[model samples]
Structures are given as structure tokens and as C-alpha cells.
Target: MNISRRALCGVALLAAVNPLGIHALASPSAPKIRVGVLKFGTVNWELDTIKHNKFDAANGIEVEVVYFAGEDATNVAMLAGDLDVIVSDWLWVSRQRSEGEDLTLAPYSTAVGAIMVKNVSPIRGIPDLVGKKIGVAGGSLDKSWLLIQGLARRDHGIDLGKEGDVVFGAPPLLSEKALSGELDAVLNFWHFCARLEANGFRRLIGADDAAKALGASGPVSALGYVFREKWADENPDAAMSFVKASAQAKKLLDESDAEWRRLAPVVRAEGGELEVLRDRYREGIPKRPLAEEERDAAKLYEILAELGGEKLVGEARQMAPGTFWAALKT
Candidate 1:
């Protein structure tokens, strides 16, 4: 095994600048936070901004991104002590904590999808959806699905799931079906819905609106940066620094149109689709305080639990203690 001077120097420089201070490595300069994200997730947009602008370094932390194929894979990696943080919903974080695993969420995107119909479709609202062929992405336990069901039941006096000829499929597949007129309406994830909108799909009701209709304060966070609470406590500086960097990245993205154009290829969107994505991403940013968000989540938890049952919410009927990781001050 031969090591060249350049390679050796590179390794030395890495060790010198990194101060992760836990599990993977020890360094004195600045702590490194290993962040696991979906390979093509929207979170990458913000992370890309952070890395491109050196926000992590400016905030006194170094970010190491590890891409995963799926959310479940990242969850396994987190529990196996292979990652420091990952983007996930508070629902999963609450479930993990309830089961004694001690996972916590830092508010990220509040973005959620909508029930969309082709512009010419007769379906205009929840009541109109009765007996219509509706496609749902992300299966039965998807929070948006359950929230819509709850809203339908509350406002329209119908088990919307039962009333509609519901079909469950992946987001992309459903989006295509809706676009081709194979489905009357479709409930898909945010990005998929954005694309559909760009292609002339009309939203019947957004998930955020459903949450509000069902008594949530406003749009609650659908996803966040999740971490092991014990690990976060041990590395408070790193944890807080990463949070600050994420906020800075989001702020930059919120204000810069040029940045959106720069990230076009990364998102695989352009023209109207790109514009829609940028707008949706900005809409999804968590603007409310932690307390307000947590409170809204608590309210939504009850409705979701009623509609989705033990499968969606696990044994815990509540949102679980420490689900929001609020103690780590931003």
C-alpha cells in the first residue's frame, strides 16, 4: 500500500480542519456533521445552497453529506450510528421516540402535496370527489391522505376514502396517470404536484389547507432534519451550527432568483416547472416559531391518529415528548 505525498497531505488537511468530535472522527478545528439525505430529495436544494455558499463553515461547522437511496435506508443508517442527521417527518421521529429510540426533529420544510385534477375534470372539491377515481401517492398512511380524509369527513360528512374510488400508487406514476386523464384526481407529494401544476393540473385542496380545515393552527412541518437526541446533546455546537447553516441556506434561496436558475439541472426542472418548484419550496419554508409549529402538530396528530390509526401514529396517540428538538436553540 503506497500513499503519495498529495494524498497524505489531503488526509492530513482533512484531519486538521475537521472537528466532528464524535463517533466518526476527532478534530480540533471545526466539528463535522454527517448529514444523510435522499439522493434526489428537495432538501438537497437547501443543502446545495449551504455548501455552495460555505454557510456551514461560516456557521462554525462542516457538513458532510451522504446520499441514500431511500428514507428507510437512511433511518436504518441513523439507528446503526452511521449518520448524524437525516431529513424526515416529525411523525416518524415521534414514533421512534415513543418506542424509546430518542429521535428528534428540527423544523425543515412544511411542504405537502395536494389533490390535483386535470383542468377539464368535473371534480372541483371534496364533495365532488365522491365516486370519482382518485389516486393517492405514498399509500394509506401518508399524512396528507389521512388529513384529507379527516377534513372530508368533518366538512362534507363523507368518508372521502370510502366515497372515492381510491387508488394508491407512487407519486410519479400517479402524476402521469392524472396528466394522461387515466385518473380523475390524484394526491401526490409536493414536487410531483408542482410538476402536475406546471402541466395544467388544478389543485382541489392543498394538504396545508386540509390541515387548517381540520383545526391545525396553519401549515405544520411535513418534514425536518432528524437526529438522535443523545448525539445532539453531546454535540450542541455542531447541532446548532448546522441548524443555523440550514436557516441561512433557506434565507438565501428565499431571496435569490438567480440561485433557482443555477439549481435547475440539480432539480431536473426547467421553465414553468422550475418556477413552480421554486415557489412551492419557498412556500414550504418553516416561518412560524417552534412552539406554534409543535402546537399545530399536536392538533393534527389527533386527527391523523383517528383516520390512520395505530399504523400511522404507532402506539402513541400523542405527538411524543421532545419530537421538536426545541432545546437546541437556533
Candidate 2:
């Protein structure tokens, strides 16, 4: 009573159309999640995962990544509804909210953005910056600048918020200007700070340090996990999933130095590297998001208020719209 060859072929054909069997073998891939990130520097970990498509397989997430060289470029894209998410300084979100841009802060992303000066220059500290020119990326709106500005006011009483006290110039020119001695120093993110330090620039206190000096009890240079508010409202589950996956990724990076070391070249490829750049990243990365709202963040809101961003104060009080943090439970 052997089965015929024709009968076996017929059974194979049926299996191809059988939903139960196909589903058991492999479920359909998870929907792709598009993420927008800064094009260069300390954002290496997220970029590496996106570049290698690592998260797609591990977390059942497909990421469509878009890169921008500066905050303005990213802000424009966010305004145009071109991005599903953005990872950047929370300061940008504060400014956007102040200006009435519709976006939601997902969670804390990173805890670092710094500024450095040349080692041999006369600019020994923030006090020396009194008459020296400085380069800043986003004029007065840049969060890094605002944090440092708040610091100068609090610590040194120089008040960089004023005109001609500290010059606002593009970031790219800072390195060249610092190297050639054309400029005294500059405010930059951590990765560039490493470069400036390696090229004989001295550490003039990072944004995190400045925040602490100004009496911030916890993390100061907080990076916000952000996206369009309308998008999050429409796709609550997807947004929740994104935040969950991002929290997982941040945890993985935090717990493993070997994994971080493996990612340095990827950072270098995305942008130029200076000595101990990876170290700078590791030093800055935090293990987890705050379980509750942070006082320091409220302090940041106050800083924005001083900067004439009253609307940011209102939005910071309601940073996370959805109660999705329950998903990040260990």
C-alpha cells in the first residue's frame, strides 16, 4: 500500500497554501519602523545597528534610517512628517515645543554632549571665554549652547546669552579654526570634543559637567527619544514597540564594553575619530531611562524658560503621552 508519486506532489501543493503550516514554519516579518538619526559622531551605536540591520533580525524590527548632518535638517524632516522617530538632545525637543512643533518625547536616549578648547590656547576655562570667540552649531537654539550658556550664567556669570560675548558659528569650521588658532574654542558634541582634545584642545567642561556645576542633581545632557506627536497617536503600538526596542538596545550597549569596542570603527567610518572617542561614548552612556520624571529635566525646562522658551516648560511636564514604559520592564 505505497503512496504514489503523484499523490505526494499533490500533498506538497496543499502545504504551500496551508496558512497554519506556513505560519508555524515562519510568521511574516514584523512591519518596518523608520528611524531618523543624526548623521555623524556619538550616535554611532544606533547607526551601527541600522547599518548592519542587526535590530531587524534580533527584535523583529525593520528600520528605515534617514541621516541628517545637523539639528535643523532633522527638525525640518520631522516637520515634514518624513521621519517616524528621532534620537537627539532633549533641548531640541524643548525648543521645538517652545516654537509649537508637534512632537512627543519618547524617553531618555543619551546623557552626553560636550565642548572643548585647544590645550595650548590662552582659554584655560569658561572664565577665559570672556573675550574669546566660540563656534556653535545651532545659533542660540542649540541645546548644547543653551546648556553651556546656562552654565556661564550660573557659574561664571559671563552670560553667553548676550551678543558678542560668545560668537555663534557653524560647527565644521570649529576644528579648522581651533587648529589654526583663528578661534579661541568651540562648543561641540562629545565625539568632536574627543577630536578637539586629541588635536591638542583642552577640556573646558562638558555640557553634563556644566549642568552639574549649575546644580543639576542627575543627568544633564539628556537625549530624548522623539517622534511626531500625530504619528505616535495614530500608531501607538508601533511607537511603543520602538521605544521598547530602543531601551533594549541602550541596555545592551551599556552592559557590554566589548560590544562598544566593536562599534568604534563604525563610529569612525560615520565620522572622523580622535583618541578615546569610544571611551567618551562609554563614559556618557547611561544604563537606563529614569523610572519617573527627573528634577534635573525640570531644571532644564527652567533653563529653557530663561532662554525665552516658556512653551518648553509646559511640554516637559508631559514628556511621555502614553503609559508604554510598562513594556520596558525587566
Among all candidates shown, the one with the greatest TM-score: 1
Report the CA-based lDDT of candidate 1 relative to the real structure: 0.84
State how far residue 223 of model 1 sits from its true place (Å).
Answer: 0.5
| Alpha-carbon deviation at 4 in model 1, angstroms | 38
- Per-residue lDDT over 175-270 for candidate 1, one digit per residue giving the tens place of the 0 to 100 score: 888888888999999999999999998889989999998788777889989998898778766777678778878887899999999999999999
Model 1 vs. true fold: TM: 0.90
Can you list the residue pairs that collide in candidate 1?
19-30, 19-31, 20-32
**What does the lDDT read for residue 178 in candidate 1?**
88
Off by over 4 Å in 2: 1-27, 41-44, 50-53, 68-70, 91-102, 161-165, 228-237, 251-265, 269-275, 288-293, 309-330
lDDT of the structure predicted as candidate 2: 0.59
